[model samples]
Target: MGAAVSDTSTRTTPEHEASRTPSPPGGRSRLAALGRAVARRRLLVLLLTLVVVAIAAALGGDVAQRLSSGGFTDPKSESSKAERFLADRFKSGVPNLVLVARAPGSVDAPSASAAGRELTERVAKAPGVLSAGSYWTMPGAAPLRSRDGRSALVLVRLGGSEDDFRATAKRLVPKVGGRQGVLDVSVTGSAQVSVEIEKRSEEDLAKAEAITAPATLLILLVVFGSAVAAALPLAVGLLSVLGTFLVLRLLSAVTSVSVFSTNITTALGLGLAIDYSLFVVTRYREELASGRDVTEAIAQTVRTAGRTVLFSSVTVALSLAGLLVFPLYFLRSFAYAGMAVVALAAVGAVVVLPALLALLGRRIDAWNINRALRRLVPHRRERGPATEESGFWHWLATAVMRRPVLFALAVVAVLVTLGLPFIRASFGITDDRELPASAPAHVAAQALRDDFDSGESSALSVVLPETDADAGRVGSFAARMSALPGVFRVDAATGSYVNGRQVAQPGPAAVRFRAPGATWMSVVPSVEPYSDAGTRLVQRLRGAPGAPGTVLVGGQAALLVDTRDALAAGLPWTGLIIAGTTLVLLFLFTGSLLIPLKAVVFNLLSLSATFGAMVYVFQDGHLQWLVGDFTVTGLLDISMPVLMFCVAFGLSMDYEVFLLSRIREVYMETGDNTRAVALGLERTGRLVSAAALLFATVMAAFATSGLTLLKLLGVGLALAVIMDATVVRGLLVPAVMRLAGRANWWAPKPLRRLHERLGLKEA
Candidate 1:
């Protein structure tokens, strides 16, 4: 049998191994064949990837055109119904812009009239503006009256879809700002919102490079202790990001890709590249120190560290793929873009990196110096053997393990307490004032609100037919709607003659309304805009009577109302999908049910804490200064929480795989959970921390972008990663595993058999 094994191994590599060994082995032959295969075909794979990306890019313009032509069409959705009704009655969509004019202090009669007239003239001539008029000057418009009479608003209707409006606004903003006596000018419309999202995404990409590149370099310098070694990971990471962008640009042609997708893809790719490269390079150094030749060290690194990286990358890609369960187009694009970036980074690490290492050999470490500076900064290997565990980490693990039940209970209690704020969570798309106080949009929005009827720039309309024009019928409908509680006022255009004719006009509309920023509605109990309560109100209004016609309710409040409902309805299913997928992947990787269960539990805990912190800072108005100037509108965006959940869960699982892969390797070899946990943490902790910090810093740079939504996402994600790396991964992970002991690796006998048959072996 031994002679046969030797003969089998030598068959593929007789010339190469004949001088080094007496006999070849099967494992050696198989590995040699695999290496040769990869070496032979690498150029083809790379060229194929580039070709695919180029094809996709070529198709993107057509895809964008199709998406732009498909305007808002969800009539069944509450907001869509309102939009349709408004379109039919007014022969137009919602006003595209709200232009504000403020008096020196407060608006007097003369100032109000002058401001309104001037705004009308200036806005009407504004480029890209189809029509601009003052609501205060229009007949039968009572909602435009401001209590203090200090502000006036000009409503500008633009021609086109949201994207068109955005393109128009980008050209119009500078011109609007140039107008005389315009204390502040802001274009707040759907188009402006899209523009802002795109602008912020670009800014985030720039900031990510600024932060991630430097942070990654610093980390490499610390780990490899050589300038060349430190620079290699950054180079690989940059290449991965560039390749990812080219691919995404191509995918955008055939699919609806979110503006935010590029930023997210770049961040994920850079992080993984740094992490995977760190693992391989570190292992290669170890092999070199053990007196292995350059080619041998590269081969050993590929066989061991490269396999770990492949498994880790596969697990992460699967986790991100869970985002497909979300119905939102943006999220689906995020999943595609994120998964592609991660896969590419993995390939770069395992294939491109190995080829480079093979070609560079000992030259990779040639930058090492033995001068005074070098003495002051010892190399990673020179610092000490990794077998020695720090007293701090050891004590922490022991204390938690000593009182396993208490530690577990304490963690759960803390997480639950933090999560309480989310129970009453509300979401909405806020006015421009939600931006920092210094932002032009915020200043303009506040000025508009202060000078006009708070609702002048905002109103809730219920469209009813002009045929119901009798005093009794109009009075009854108006009284019923107004008295429905929370209804501020109801204006029915009764007894009015159009073109001097008294004939009942079926298309003539009746508008019912409420106070600006009111939290209540007749159809549902008083609830904040975009909250579950408000969404329910929208549903009730849609079902309400309008005699011969349907009543559609819409406004900023209504859009938020619908968005919240959609998110809430979808959240439970999304959570289940993510959790289920993560569990399956963990079981497949570790061949243990307990580890996956533990991972899920801890991930939830980390997520809960993250949400609580978001509420405390963004909602409850804590740490306002540290986070930058943001107005607390007492509500969060409904989509923010769902987006955060998907992102945070995936990232937490990413670190879990990194830490646990090392632990599992040790466990398989020694069957000692405690020793494995300790040693694994010690070995992987620095790299994990570095990776987390790089990501956090990249995200944190967005806080300065002057976009509230992007800033919120950045701050929220940065906090989650910091907490996960330090609190969850560093402390809680080891503690729980030590307590679970042998049971953590337990699997049923049948499952073990399955694992043996199908399990992936370490390369």
Candidate 2:
């Protein structure tokens, strides 16, 4: 031991000696020191902020191209597998273009038929179309023409995934969809609808941002009572948004980012930057109001409010990171966008905003736009912590404390009742219904479903493992499928069979079903697509007894089944990961296990109410007139609610962190649980509501978008945030903490020891 110690002593050098010395203090201590340093070098910090914004602007322009349009299903599922086989072997892809050709009188009239056939021939020879066929050419095909005979359909299969197909489809639209001989033409299908959804979403994202910006600026002006103070958070929001785009651009080089992620990136970045900046700026002004000098106030504010922003951001980021457990890129991409936004927003609040504060000094309140408004309330100063004016929050807290059990029971009842709609939620993939009724794709799809006995888009394609000389087994499989309760008909290379009756011999319609080593069968549905009956038929087809491993199902119905199962399978584990980490993080912040657990329960209650309202309004069509052109599918898309839960949970916990941190701060200083809860409620109550209102407003603007799914996200999140601020934070939190008493800070002795050694706190 003596020799080893002597050798170690000899090996230590100047750099090693410095590295081995006691590490600098961390958390609030380190932040306090850094805040002082930044105050001393305010100009340098300002320049650094400018540099970050400039670099982000340079890189962010190309981010749109990197994001993809589709990621709603598991790529490894049976549906995807079947599509792969069909595409590769059959030289077949899902029909990506549809032409709804209409005539003045009747489709079979000489003038209309000549025009329709001419359009079909021209489309068949179009650059991207591998094949095109219409009711004009296919005699006696009832499914190809409308019941009234005034309109007929033309289906085209387009291969290759690039601008070639979209560009070609657009060109065909003007030529074929316009006047073609005596008929009028309109086009919609898989590719055209996908294009429209992308275009509309991009426009909506821009519109949401446009509305949010001026509104956020105006709200901030009122909150801070001065243009200069208000501009600080807005500045942070802009920088954070640009920075998030650059981060996404970098991520794109490694993986395909979804365009949907961009919408989230902007929305969350704007809200969170304002939130963190509001907290910090509020604290800084408080220190100044108490007569601290500029440097002291900036340092103190960073130490406390800055620290709170750090923890709040961590909790939010971790909540999103839990989404990484799912296999879908759509969920994982959100994790990417969310974490980047939170990190950038937090950094701007702590580093850049503080430096600006030090430079501005008393000028932080320059350009007082609300001077007249301020006169309405005497003794008005923009203090960070609450004053005598916060009596409302204090009085409410006292009332809740007096009857904690009753308040808790009442809140729980409302939350539970609200979540009842989710019990029967029907999960479907996004379709024409996601678009507004005015969308051409939506109109065309509606016409097709209404007029035709069977729309090809809804037909389930079943692929057999082998293309057989054994025509006997092929006929047998077709017989078995056609006899099922919901099967409209089964068409295959063997023949065309309807309800177990041979309607037609093998013909041109069955040509696409033949391929080397694999043959496919199309099972048309008698029930409404995406309904429970349709899903059951898909399940039965997949479970067809004779060929356990030989069959694969692909279609809209199959896609939903696979997607629903995939989401369901990952959900429990996702919940566990999020809940577990949230518990740990909150415990580290508050040094109390019970407090973290209470937070989770309360968050769920608030989210349940939001979900309940979603069902009542969007799913049940209760407020149809409020949001125009809503076509209620009597169900929700599978992805939207999951996406909402992930985003809303993080945001809800953001408020939770703010409320709990304030309460814990007071409790630590005073050592009186009741006084702590009251004081904490008093301080954070107005701030939480203001922040919630601003964020909810940003979300509500998105609800104005034309799409049903976009409307669902907007309304659901806005309602959730409002509920958290008013009901959960104001009433439920205080009531529960009052009931829990000192137990709110309790921990196991071992955990208490661990927290003592390594725990976080606001200054």
Candidate 3:
């Protein structure tokens, strides 16, 4: 123990030691004191942890059932208002359930017509169906018939929330779908698509768990060289996941939470648990190797690595907080789950993990596998931990520092080039194409696309709940809407219109379009519902003159437009929240204005490259073989990039904090900027690399999902972590720091005083 202190003292100059602020009177940092307390109560802490895990297990078993399958739309947008008006006034909204019935021959086959009417009547009279209409029931409804003249449409509006409608679809599809007498029937709609996505997501979650757990454990064994040491991280990971499930389950009771959040909870909880525990365990082992007593080693490990873990967790949680500013509950759910799981993982690492280690003492390294492995392969022995001036990472840092400008420019150019494709990114909502071709809902939706002349189910619904215009004026409005570009036809209370002319007079179907004091028009578009042209058509409809009353346009394209507008409005606040909190936290940790600013900017750069890759692969459909086959929509899902930015930016800052914490400690100890950078990279480079690898593995498992949205998220995050860990952390950070020199740690005088009072430092 004395020799260890002597070695540390010898490594630092007297001037550097004198320049450092002294600790409080007891000379024990709060984390160190907490570590001692934990050591004293190790048994009790483990027992309490077991009890909590047990409770979490009991309460979280039904979490999957409770999570909703939809939250993509902005509930406060005009589209939402339009939907509400339709539902409140007419007891119906857009059709979210469709059944296609196909005939064997043309000329309106008698058997197919009877089967289609029977199917529509059966569904319309069903318990959850709000309204139903078909080609056979609605007069002069040519749009309901396929262009090929084999299949006709049966559109039904299921009345409820997304979850309720999805549940109704699940109950109704299997009963009415498939062969109906002489006709072939298939059921699909937005609700059914969401149901299928939820099912696939659950399956993918299980598959991801199966792939990540054993693989992560194996990697942990190789990294730690001890089965006992490797198992500790897995245990903490499991605890964190269970705790997050409970948190999500509880949150789901009072507010909307997306089912997909379960996957994130598992991936992030396990990955961060492994990251934080690995750092703590590695530092503890190093302290033990220095001949310190078990208690003292535990205290020192908590004081340093534990503090870093806490800081890293906070940075991650704060970055995730940016998602809350968005109106979409889908993104907000991730924010909730992410923040909760990060906090739990941090607690598990710093509190529970330390207690477990304290109890184990030297047994933490029991059941060593490195010796046996080395004996089997003499050339493949595990290396010892590197010293300050040594190791491959140290060499790379020195090399990059030697020509900082050249290296910086080269790396930045590569990153910017990779990011160039994002300049042309096209954004749209997730649709049936998000599902794999093998999915039944995808097959049904594809049939609609291939057979139908226009998207009737995705028609823009122009609702006028209090229109006072006469029937002739209403007919004029419908005629004008039909003449607009992209509009195939318009159905109103007065009649059906095509190309500025009324083609059909009031019929049985026209009654549904009117009430005592209100009316609505269905403007069916010729363009794809999720296409840019579809969005433009919606904007044009909203701007069209000669409306009878207050007009609110709603439909799939309108929903997309409103959602994009909502995201655009919230994006600045989200940026401010993420960047501002990151600056404050990093400043508190490093007391350096430049480092925090650099971290925020670099994270954005790395994320830009990731977004570019997402566009090139998922949007442009260049790497279908890599991420598995998916429909090429020519536009990325609008909500995914925002979610990815929050998650990937958080993770990028996670690595940043890990590296900066070590660098700051070394800088404080030696006051040599260049030496500190080199030593810090030597100490933490392997740790960050290992953590990123494990996290990337977890995210890669998500890329195997059949859903393209999940695949985009998984592939994007994995790419971001790898790029951040390697290109950003390994190359760019050292080069930039070397160029900055002493200014890397600079702050204004007032801010320096503030940092001195509030900054985090360990004894």
Candidate 4:
């Protein structure tokens, strides 16, 4: 609620055909039977999918309409209490729109003054306007004019939810935001910023879709070696996405889902659909190539890859579900949307894709889009530890295993160094500054910061919920607040007091400072907001000695203080839930306490790296030149890093699922840890990297976004994804496992039995 405006922004593979360990007997037969059933009833599966698609489309089209723009602040905070109380009682307790006007020369110019006055008048008359005041109209309001005399602000009060405000802003923007002769007009405020952010998010989502969709298709085609095969993953992705929209729509009835969650849902849904479908189709092809009949191949594919796909989804969905631990709907929305997409992706790939594969048979590769490209790209089978394609992964594993300490230390050093920036991360609230410089809202916000001084209007308010204080009592409290270190003035029902002295007599405007059930006062800080002096002053007021009733602090400052505390408070629990789930899932998969601990450590380390990168790149303004435009806020929003951690950890674990399943399968068969590590790398390295690349592509597409927040999410997640899939999962995992030796798969008898009974398995 900083500035009282808030905005926030899998895989499987199976293989058969290699004569290595021979497929396990017990579960394979059952999986084969299930696959045969699905294959034989392919028509029914298709029919069911059609029904789902239609239903989701019908209900989910309005999902975007249902989404909320801002809910990042904690409701438990004192600031939230004040905001809600004020909104309910005062009708327009907060200023939601600011019409900023600037003359090329100075506000002293007659023409400029006229234009500024005209702009404010037009804005005041605009639909939904509650009250508007400016230096032009409010004769003595010095804070509304720039000290330099070139600019001024028209503050507006429009009462509504963020959605309602957006509707108002949409109609009012064109009327006020356009250039007016020599005076430039721009709109920016709590509500305008939210509207701008929503608009930018929409543009960025469309752009990302336009960019990622084709790139994903091309990559899938190359990976699957045929158009038909590639299309299946795309189809699963579409189904997951549309279905997630429907899920979000269903969720809307219960709670607010931030609009920013949509980008993540679509990107993740597509990436995971592709990831899961890739595993399923590849295994199906392998089964077919192994000379199995269609029905048998489908069964074998389901037995191994299908099972692996389900496991991957669980890990990913659980990783996201961990986000539910945080109270903020912004984070929870992602968890809900991600869970739906992942569950649906798993179903599509495991249950639906198998039927399609069964029907396609050998024709799954019929289109052969990679025929010409095959000469350029060596096949996965041909590439080993010696060749270039997937061989580097093999070589890296072998190299790391040969010198575990050296590789492990080296990789750890690199990852830790990448994470170093986060140690210095100064988390702050997101403001209009997160918008690109080209945006009018951003420009207007900058103008406000540059022009306006700390004053009564710009200051924070404290509300007394059940105060029955007489005018004299209110005057005494005002005097005490005025004496605070940085408080220049205080406005209450009795009068306007400055420097602990009464300045002006109570006027009609004084009614704002009083109410029958409650009384409120504004505290004007002597120092500029967000500065050390100003922040310290705010702290003093919050702790100030005397007040009549239940006082709740509400303003940009309180929002920051409360939000920071909330994130801190919720983090340990969020971490527990996330780490706990990861531990349980990995333990079930690997049957080893050490591996799950190892996975949790590695994931946190990688998340630190991502957070550090966010701080360095976006917060520090390191890539301003390359990333288009945004002023460095010098701090990342609390929500960005927290949400990123949940999503990225899940993504990192996505690759972990693919790689570990292979490692576990091989380990169970050979009992040779080193061989299992190498073979797992050999089996999955190419696919994992490809999947990471494609996922990265989807993420990176949003890197082109004009919105700084979306850019941060995209770039930060891309960094985590690529590094986790390649460096962490590929090299470090092998090195660590190699160093651990037998301990990598070690578990006590009791836990091992639990795993045997409860663990999910693939062929």
Return the top candidate by TM-score: 3
On TM-score, who's better, 2 or 4?
2
Q: Candidates ranked by TM-score, best first?
A: 3, 2, 4, 1
Q: Global lDDT for candidate 4? A: 0.77
Clashes of each: 8, 0, 0, 1
lDDT by residue (444-532, candidate 3, tens digit) is 88898888878877878998878842545788988999999999999887888999999988788777787777888888899977778
For model 3, state the Cα shift of residue 124 in Å.
Answer: 0.7
User: Which 10 consecutive positions of candidate 3 have the poorest summed lDDT?
Assistant: 1-10
Q: Estimate the TM-score of every prediction.
A: 0.80, 0.92, 0.96, 0.90
Predicted model with the maximum lDDT: 3
C-alpha lDDT values of all predictions: 0.62, 0.80, 0.86, 0.77
Q: After superposition, how far is residue 441 of candidate 3 from its true place, in Å?
A: 0.9
Per residue, candidate 2 scores C-alpha lDDT tens digits across 465-534 of 6655245678777877888888888877778778777777776666777766678888878887689998
Q: Model 3's lDDT to the true fold?
A: 0.86
Q: What digit string (tens of lDDT, one per residue) describes model 1 on residues 413-456?
A: 87788878877665666456445576565666566555543343
Better of 2 and 4 by lDDT: 2
lDDT of 1 at 183: 37
Give the distance in Å from residue 149's predicted Cα in candidate 1 to where it truly belongs.
4.7
